[model samples]
Target chain A: MIPTLQVFLIVSAALFSAGLLAALSRRHAIFILIGIEMMLAAANLNFIAFWRFNPQSQPPTGVMIAIFSIAIAAAEAAVGLALVIAEF
Target chain B: MSSAAFVLIAILTLAAALAAATLQKLMHATLSFAVALVGVAAFFFLLGAEFVGLVLVFVYIGAVAVLIVFTILLTRRDVGKDRGANWSGALLAVAVFGGLGWAVFKTQSVAIAAPHIRALTVKRIGEALMTSYVWPLQCVGLLLTAALIGALVLVMEEKR
Candidate 1:
């Protein structure tokens, strides 16, 4: 059977915790950045899950946000890594 | 059939996420993080959001992952194994997961199967972006440009 919305949410939660684990436990700055990125990706997944399951009366809001989110994420990664490079 | 796919992809993603979180080596952790991202893209495709899936693969794996790897290489002065993972952090993560899981189970509304939906096409997304979302799209472009310049300015070597 296709997984329900609950299943997707649970998975996203698991991913978020894993991100927290990385961010909290690791000493490296890069690890912290990775953790943050993972957390963002999980949020995107949650948004997509909600978008997919619900009946759409509006435009593709979820996908649009997700795309914009991805762009922002890339920008964040670039800036973050540059900061890391400048720091260490 | 889709459930099986979901299970497989979920396992892969979760396992990769665990690897990314707990791995001792920095490079290995980064690579596993990339793998986890690929699994997320797979999930997007499975959900019939092919355009989002493609964008995820391109932006994350293609761009972000490469940037991370490059950063690692540049900062390799002491790329030794990271300090060991903390048990307290793991415990806290588990606690948070338990809380979220309980909330998920208690909410009876989210347990329903996915409603039948039409495939999301790139054309619809383009039209929406061009029409209703145009302002936000323009803002994103500006945001990206600012981020690009900011990163360059931050990284440029200072003159003696």
Candidate 2:
């Protein structure tokens, strides 16, 4: 048996907290961006975990949502960093 | 629920987070973040979301991380070592985050249990995207296009 979904949630929480710490503690703007990415990734992990333990009738829908989210995140990061670059 | 894979993921997650937090060099921090992303992708795979896992790696590790590094390189004249964490800030973060974690765990204890995962195939996802989520899909496409246009304008403004 795999570790329960609860364990995954805990791990995600830990990741999020670490990212938060980085965001707060780091002075550099770039490190803050990395922290933001970490938080997003942590959320993505939760989505996948829930999808796995809680099987939907449709099955692939959950994973597809995550995939689409990843794509959107990529686009957002691109535009965000581009703006950061242009700004600084 | 105590599989070896879960243990591996837990270890990877914790280790990567530690690296990202403790590393002084900006480039090293970015690399640690990549490691964490890889660990996250692996977690997705274990959750039976192979498509999601692959996309996580490709979009996040391949595209987004690289773009961020490029931005750092281009924007900053020097990517130096970050001064390590401030003690007061770290303490405050830990306190707030610890409370949040406790709340999440406590709520989960009362919520409905999750069902076993069954369908995680690519075919099912494609069908759902085409059918139930058509509008959202279109919206995302439009958003991406707009973002790209905005990025171009911002960069051009810098050149001027």
lDDT of each: 0.90, 0.78
DockQ values, each candidate: 0.80, 0.61
A1-88: candidate 1 lDDT, tens digit per residue: 7699999999999999999999999889899999999999999998898998887625878888889999898889988888888887
* TM-score per candidate, chains pooled: 0.96, 0.90
Deviating ranges (above 4 Å) for candidate 2: A55-61, B108-114
Candidate 1: stretches off by over 4 Å: B158-160
CA shift of B143, model 1, Å: 0.9
The model with the greatest DockQ is 1
User: Which 10-residue span in candidate 2 chain A carries the lowest summed lDDT?
Assistant: A55-64
Cα distance off (Å), candidate 2, residue B111: 9.2
